[model samples]
Target: MVDEALRAARAVQSRLRDLPSRVVIYLILAACLFPEVGYPGVWRKLTGALVGLPVAAPTASALAQAR
Candidate 1:
C-alpha cells in the first residue's frame, strides 16, 4: 500500500531501497526544529518516542543518502 502511494506520488527513492523517501521526508520535517541534533539523533529520538518506525533505523550515511 505504501509502495503504491509512493509510486502514485512519485515519492519512492532510487532502486537501492536502502531507505524509503517517505521516511526521509518525515525525518526532514522533524529535523527543522532540532537541526542541531542531526539526522541520526533525530532518528534515535523519533524511533524511541514518536512513531514506532516500521523500517529499521538507517545508518547516518544511509539517512544522508535518503535525504
Candidate 2:
C-alpha cells in the first residue's frame, strides 16, 4: 500500500542520521566562509568532538596476551 511504502521511506530516512552531521558541517563551513553570519562555535565544538571520539582500550589480560 502507499501508506506502508511511505512509512518504510520515513524509517529509512530516520536511520540515515548522518545527514544531520553533514548538514552541521556544511553550516559551519558557510559561517566560516561568510563572516557576516557569525561564528558557528557550537557546531564547531560538536563536530570536533565527534571527530575526536574516544577509543576503547583492551582489557588487561587481552593486552598482555597480544604482547
Candidate 3:
C-alpha cells in the first residue's frame, strides 16, 4: 500500500544520487513496524534484511536527510 501510494504520488521517481526513495519509504514503514526500536535499531534491522540484496544501506545522515 505504501509502495502504491508513493508511486501514485510520484515519490519513487527522483534524480537523487543516494538513497532511492522506495528504500526510504520502506525504512519509514519498518520504523513504524518496530516502534520499540529507535532509528538506529530500525536501520540495523533494515540493513540486515537488505544484506542479500544488491543495494547498499543508506547512511544514518542520508536517512535523516531523506526523511
* Candidate closest to the true structure, highest lDDT: 1
Judging by TM-score against the true structure, name the best candidate: 1
lDDT of each: 0.76, 0.42, 0.75
Off by over 4 Å in 3: 1-3, 49-57
lDDT of 2 by residue, 1-67 (tens): 5335546556323444423333434544555666553343433433465655753333334322322
Off by over 4 Å in 1: 1-9, 13-18, 50-55
Lowest summed-lDDT stretch of 10 residues in model 1? 49-58
Ranking by TM-score: 1, 3, 2
Q: How close is candidate 2 to the true structure, as a TM-score?
A: 0.28
Give the lDDT ranking, best first: 1, 3, 2
Question: Each candidate's TM vs. the true structure?
Answer: 0.65, 0.28, 0.63
lDDT of 3 by residue, 1-67 (tens): 8778888887776576556777778778888999887666788887776666776656667777776
Among all windows of 10 consecutive residues in model 3, the one with the lowest summed lDDT is 49-58
